[model samples]
Target: MLRLESVYLRLKNGSEEVPILENINLDLEDNKFYALTGPNGGGKTSLAKVIMGIYKNDEGRIYLDGKDITDFSITERAKAGISYAFQNPPRFKGLKIKDLLKISADENSLRAILRSVGLCPQDYLDRECDSGLSGGEMKRIELASVLARPSRLVIYDEPEAGVDLWSFENLLQLIRNYHKRGNVTSVVITHHERVLSLADEIILLVDGKIADRGSRDKILPLIQEDARCCWKANCGGNNDEVECY
Candidate 1:
């Protein structure tokens, strides 16, 4: 289980302090799937970063399965069974795909991990995880690396980004399978309705705070209603100015 108590975060904009997350309190249960969704720039990703230890909270405590990890570094958090997949996965200039997988897990299991993400080890194992790889390829490789590790909490920031339709569908199924195994707690930050529908619970964040949270059956209809309003004619004053809910 993961718990956040009265968490707050602020950012420095020039000389002024701007609040990014405000009074966040949450308890994420083990072996559950959560979808965190809201409009862009709503601090959804910032909250994930704080949980992953990429960013520190200015106030309050974070506990993972009874241990206080509020002051833990990113490396410490990873060792504590927290894994995060970035929105834009970094490209390693000198690292081979197989080498990264090997570092993530044993060499004997590398091929299976690659194949799980729809990559052929014989073709990609020798290639460097550099600019030569497509965005979707890099994303899959990053996800595969995460899968190689044993994690109690897995957070994926926009996993569907930069992938083709077919790849996106496959990725969704992969995630579903992983979640069904009940080995880790999953948090997916996504705006897609398909992804949102898969969650056991949906958290709606707005203006740096949780606006609402409930089971998918309870929250999805509200989101769908909002989307429907935005798609109607003259919803945004004119068709040329259509707004996404």
Candidate 2:
């Protein structure tokens, strides 16, 4: 459903140019769930932004349903049936949840959107999106926005970040249900093992490139094996480990 051909992104800092993505070539089929996991600074999020048109590519092309969209604006991409949820959601001061929902799904459809996110319509509709809400609440609000848009391609950048255990599980179920509904392609960027297990394919990004990409059997074992060495007290692995999966 989506294709990225020889995509490249570079940031210009005075005379220096830092390449964030180098020659990225990927094809995403319709109605599939793709999970991208990698160490920090591996360009996973950068590639997501590139797909969403939040960052312009310095080389190559991006095509949505066979049409070149490499130079499309973010708003244009959204209009073209693409939705994105950021790692750190933005707070719109003085904006009530109902207003945002009405804007995305139309005033007549707000209740349905809230229900999709497991939220009570009446209780949340009048609430302002601000510091008063908990992290998990904000995450759910962002998710509701995505559901309201009903895009063909939804790129969630670490949807599990702020969510509590119960909410995280709920999010997983919601995503699974969305996938089963058909015609929607999802690209989830997460490092959680449980989340990765839900993917049809796990793409491991390393140093701005795809180092490993395959089914769970092909990739999970490698990470698990490597974790044997680098696991620490906080991450639940031994500190003296070497070549950990």
Candidate 3:
């Protein structure tokens, strides 16, 4: 299980302090998928980064399986069964796809890893991680690496960002397969409704806070309504308070 208690991150904007995340509390049960959705600049990415230990929380604690990981470094968090995939994956100049997958899995061969992400071993295994690969190809390769890594909690930041429609569906099915095979906890950060529907639970973040948290059926309508009203529903004017998104 994963638990975040009153987690907060503060940063400087000009001279004033801005809250990237407010007093947030979340509990994620084991062997489930949670999808986080929100508008741009709503702090969804920041929260994901904080959970991965890329950014330290100014206040609050993070616990995985009841152990405090707030003081842990990024490597420590990875060692503790947390894996994160970035929205914009970095390019490795001379590394072949097979080499990257092998390193990610800490093993000899990565044929299964490549296959899991719908890549053909004979075709892509030797390709370099460079500009020669298209954007969708890079996204799939990064996803293959994420699947290769054996981690209890896997966080995918915009897995559907650059991929084509066919590949996107393939990726989604692969994630479902992963859930069935390993029963590993997964967190997906996406803006699309189709991606949101794939989650076991949907968390809507607004203004650096969890505005709504529930099953997809319960939250999707609210999100649509929120979008229609320009994020102001029932309430009269623009209020800073973050309600169910």
lDDT of 3 by residue, 1-245 (tens): 88999999988899998889998899998998899998888898898899999989999999999999999999999999998888888899899987888867755558877777777889998889988888778888888888776788988889899888877888988777777776489999998889888788999898899999999999999988877867434344556554544
Extract clashing residue pairs from model 1.
none
Residue 77 in candidate 3 has what lDDT?
92
Q: Which stretches of candidate 1 lie over 4 Å from their true place?
A: 229-245
- Relative to the true structure, how large is the alpha-carbon lDDT of every model? 0.90, 0.84, 0.86
lDDT of 2 by residue, 1-245 (tens): 89988888898769999988888888889988989998777898888888888888899899999989888999999999999888777888899999876768788788887877778898899999888887778888898888766788998889898788876898888877877888899989998999899899888887688888899889999888766765433332654553333
User: What is candidate 3's TM-score against the reference?
Assistant: 0.87
Higher-TM-score candidate among 1 and 2?
Answer: 1
Answer with 1 or 2, whichever has the higher lDDT. 1
Prediction 2 global C-alpha lDDT: 0.84
Span of 10 residues, lowest total lDDT, candidate 2 = 231-240
Off by over 4 Å in 3: 12-17, 106-108, 231-245
lDDT of each residue in 1-245, candidate 1, tens digit only = 99999999999989999999999999999899999998778898899999999889999999999999999999999999999988889899999999888877888998899998999989999999999999999999999998788789999999999888888998888877877877799999999889998899999987799989999999999888876765433443676766455
